[model samples]
Target: MEIAAAIQRRGLLFVLSSPSGAGKSTIAQMLLSTDDGIAMSVSATTRPMRPGETDGVDYHFVTDAGFDRMVAGGEFLEWAHVFGHRYGTLKREVMKVIEGGRDVLLDIDWQGTQQLKQVDPDIVRVFILPPSTEELERRLRHRGTDSEEVIARRMDRAASEISHWAEYDYVLINNDAEKCRELVHNILKAERLKATRRVFLHDFVRGLIG
Candidate 1:
């Protein structure tokens, strides 16, 4: 048998971060649906649970004080305050998934990605940017029913977020969403086959030689 066949691999944290109007979440959902080995990392939040949302499924809802305590105790791998609510990833839970040789997909912002990188430097970071600033604004306006002021604020935030594209490992210009999705699928497949991530490769090779 080939050594590659025998080597067991470790999973990676696949992160996708983008501006407010970019299709990060849509891409993430598409990835999850297509890839059975990867699972979405449910986040813990301090916000009130909305209708039809389940605990430990949609989000692990907690009190604001409890969230503060978790942050202070360093229980979260990454946490961020978004639109007046706190959201975080539980380090223990994510570690468990990674150890099981199944990838975890994270749809988060640049700040959260930075925090996650500090904890797990081996994570694969991918940033998706709209084809152009004008296109991003158009997408935002088309999707949101908010007032002009809110939309303008979102546009400003998108500009600020796009400035961090240089920080990511891979940057994809999302001119066409379907094409971008295929590109991301290819990236993940390549990352999964990386020799460095195959922790049992050495032993498997030795066995094959012996």
Candidate 2:
């Protein structure tokens, strides 16, 4: 067998961050649909369930009191308040996925990414940027999901989000959605092949030499 196929590798946390309408969600959906080795890390939130969302699959929706209890118990790897809603990643669940050798994909904001890094510095961070602010506004309008006021708010917020692009390990311009997805996949593949992740490679090499 080839070295890539023979070596046992540890999994990693892959984080993707982008402002609204910058193609983050589209890329995330594409990756989840195409990649079997990676799975989305379901977040727990204190927000009410949306119309089409499922309980455990979309988010682990909880009451404010329940979320507070979890925070008090140190059950979260990272937690943040966004738009008056509390969102968090459960440490036990994410560690379980990583320990089982399956990469976890996180679609979170910059704040959550920073917190996750403090917890697990090995995470790979990628930020997507729109080609231009005007293009971003156009994409948001194309969606037709939000009101005029909401779109205006999102445009204002995008500026702040884009300022943190330098903090990510990799930054991609989302001018072409498909091309960007391909680049993201390539990054994941390369990260998976890194020598550090192949924990038993040295032993494998020794056995081969013997």
For this target, which candidate reaches the highest TM-score against the unseen true structure? Answer: 2
Where does candidate 1 clash, by residue pair? none
Best by the lDDT measure: 2
Per-candidate TM-score against the hidden true structure: 0.87, 0.92
Residue 127, model 1, lDDT: 99
lDDT of 2 by residue, 2-75 (tens): 54543368888999999999999899989988888888888999988977899988899999999999999999
**Clashing pairs for predicted structure model 2, backbone only:** none
In model 2, which runs have C-alpha deviations exceeding 4 angstroms?
1-7
Off by over 4 Å in 1: 1-7, 48-53, 145-149
Displacement of the residue 143 alpha carbon in candidate 1, Å: 3.1
Candidate 1 lDDT over residue span 33-133, tens digit each: 88877888888898888767899987889999899899999999899976568889988778777677688998888889999999889999999999888
Q: lDDT at 110 for candidate 1?
A: 89
